[model samples]
Target: MGRHRNDPRGIAQMVAIGGVIVLFITLVILGGFFLYKSLPSGSDTAAVPEGAAGTTADPQAEEMPTGSLYIRAVGESSEVVVTVPGGDVLADTTLKTDEYLSFTEERTLSVTIGRPSEVEIYVHGERQDVEGEDPGYSFAVQP
Candidate 1:
């Protein structure tokens, strides 16, 4: 039958084709694995707790902002004289601890001067002062 028609050549061609197919399959599998790893991890979700979804917790989730202020007299029992803008005393009673004397509609704050020294007033964590006028030794707080 014409010397078996070069059977070795056909076997070699089949082996080459099989090698190429195996290489293509390996490349596809590797590409899929890399894509899965590049996707967002469980820590990226906002509603889920960190470290419980087989991933570390989000660093931002642990931080929170608590908006509040605490004011205290700079000295031991100084005369905290408080006033409104128009030379109006905040209240008839002297401002002390556990008292709410310096508030205006929950926005504007009345400042308290403890004595006749230069006093510094603050509102919302910012300085509120009069130009060229001494605030006296009273302390003020923002509401």
Candidate 2:
């Protein structure tokens, strides 16, 4: 019987096929990862009740068209002011430690914390870091 090996030709073809497979696998994994990350992490939330702009242990969540933002007071008492760009105060209330308020709106929201060290913000369950050491830590987020 004669050997059926095609010297370098067969080896080159096999190498090329292996390279293609690796490239395909890498792309698939990266594509899937980005797709998963792009999805909205927070589900639909309840709308913040109208005229409840005061102290509340747990304010109702807002059902905005854009996305979700979770703000929690981690101090004995924290003052939070959430407002829209056009002078509409979404929620102006004091949150007790461990209390949180959720806001989800299509428009941008500006959050001002009287005591920055006593608040925690979350987007899709990821904690956010606000840049301010003095009181009245302020930041704007679009959700």
Candidate 3:
């Protein structure tokens, strides 16, 4: 056999080509990682316009409501059950005289009162009339 035919040069050349391919792949992956880190995030993309009415740059400003419901037990002790319309009950407990509760809901609420005269209801700081509703009455209120 000739020396050139039996030489190990071909194996060395194959290994060098494989090393170059691996190095090129590693560089491409690292470049993609650095590019991703330099880009702006999704939260920073939207900028609030200037001089817009009722527009706030704060992220929490969009979560608040314009009004809420306020309930108080005034004349005497009473048991109250507050439920969402056709849904689960939010509160089912007793309230003593001068005790107060508040909530914020966008839909109508079904309020069951053990003593209508003892419980007082308010919406957005305005007192609501509960004169005609008798004791053990359940009524619906919206906010």
Candidate 4:
């Protein structure tokens, strides 16, 4: 007698094939996730703007002058000076290698770095190329 489509052996074989397919799909998805995580994500510090030293305004963060300035000492020990027009100094101190500082300032602000190449600056969530041709670098931001 010929076996029917719903026979016990046929049902078992179909279930096994379905399980194998599911396992294969799961493995493929897991492999893709690992590959994505393994790739280099790059550093946020590398987002500095190209060409001349200046502040690149971020349109998305242009609501007000209330924003934070991030300073990281990359090279040797250096001093970071922040001044606001008609206001007290925001920050004035020496930053050593791997050391960092941040301050929230409003309105017009000025920043001076003793060692241009030794420091990295970010304003209002945007990277500012404070490194200039000279040893020291300074720039003013109005917003």
Candidate 5:
């Protein structure tokens, strides 16, 4: 009969190496998936339109997160104040040229804008009218 070459240590070593290889492959795949997602898909975004318009509900109801609001300052910069319906200020900051502020609250939000004429407002992906305020003024948006 031929000598048998069955070593327990060798079998365990092979299994450990196989596990390491699988881990490495999984890490590589996840890295590539995240990189692809991070890249910008397009530069042609929809424009909000001119003039001070009011906040609009999502017509398609698919562009933004449900029960949340996304407010963006387009074309120019503006000072904004974000508050809940109870008048508690959540944020008061100045938006630079083309900036955005997001609110997670579902209640109505009051946004006071400075330099309203130069700044354009966009809610979610659709354009919003600043309510036709030429100077510093305020408007409301409910999500």
Candidate 6:
């Protein structure tokens, strides 16, 4: 009763080591699901203010708004919210570390955002008067 010698090359090397451990766990779960969907998924929600300035009391002596809202920062922090509608002004602007914030306007704007930041609201004074449209402010950012 000694019939034990059926090694088909050790079951084809244990099925090629279980198909290389299931192709390395399916490429590490599709590379962690595309690195969690390329990160930066904070879902951006507020940022809109670029030109048309007149919150009174001097911001370079007001009166210059044909569109200009520029905030720059590659990394470290950013929060912006600028809303201006016939006077109930709002400004929560912040761009830290590599800092930069600018505005000039003629009234008419809207912005909502979050995370993965890099903004440049255009139409800036190419000799002014692109025919009015700027004045909207409320910004936010810290650290």
TM-scores of all candidate predictions against the true structure: 0.30, 0.52, 0.48, 0.48, 0.45, 0.29
Q: lDDT of each structure?
A: 0.41, 0.69, 0.64, 0.66, 0.61, 0.46
lDDT of 4 at 116: 76
* Candidate 1 ranges with C-alpha deviation above 4 Å: 1-6, 45-143
lDDT at position 77, candidate 4? 71
lDDT of 3 by residue, 35-85 (tens): 999886745222223332222223223332234555566675778777776
Superposed model 4: Cα runs more than 4 Å off: 1-66
Q: What value of lDDT does candidate 4 attain over all alpha carbons?
A: 0.66
Over the stretch 51-70, how does candidate 1's per-residue lDDT look in tens digits?
22121213243222112222
- Model 3 segments beyond 4 Å from truth? 1-67
Best by lDDT: 2
Q: Report how far off residue 33 is in candidate 4 (Å).
A: 54
List residue ranges in candidate 6 displaced over 4 A.
1-6, 25-67, 73-76, 81-96, 99-107, 111-143
The CA root-mean-square deviation of candidate 3, after full C-alpha superposition on the true structure, stands at 15.1
Candidate 6 per-residue lDDT, tens place, 1-143, comes to: 64345778777887999999999999999999999998866643223334424322222323443435544434555555555556534455654433434445555543332333343333354331211233333332210
**Candidate 5 lDDT, 1-143, residue by residue in tens:** 74345777777888999999999999999999999998866543322323223323232334443234555555556677777777677666666544555555567888788877656565544666664776668777767
The CA lDDT at 4 in model 4 is: 100
Q: Give the poorly placed runs of model 2, Cα more than 4 Å off.
A: 1-67
In TM-score terms, which candidate is top? 2
Tens digit per residue, CA lDDT, model 2, 1-143: 65358768777888999999999999999999999998866643223446744322343433322235677766677788888898998787777666677765677778888887787777555677863566887778765
Determine which window of 10 residues in candidate 2 has minimal summed lDDT: 57-66
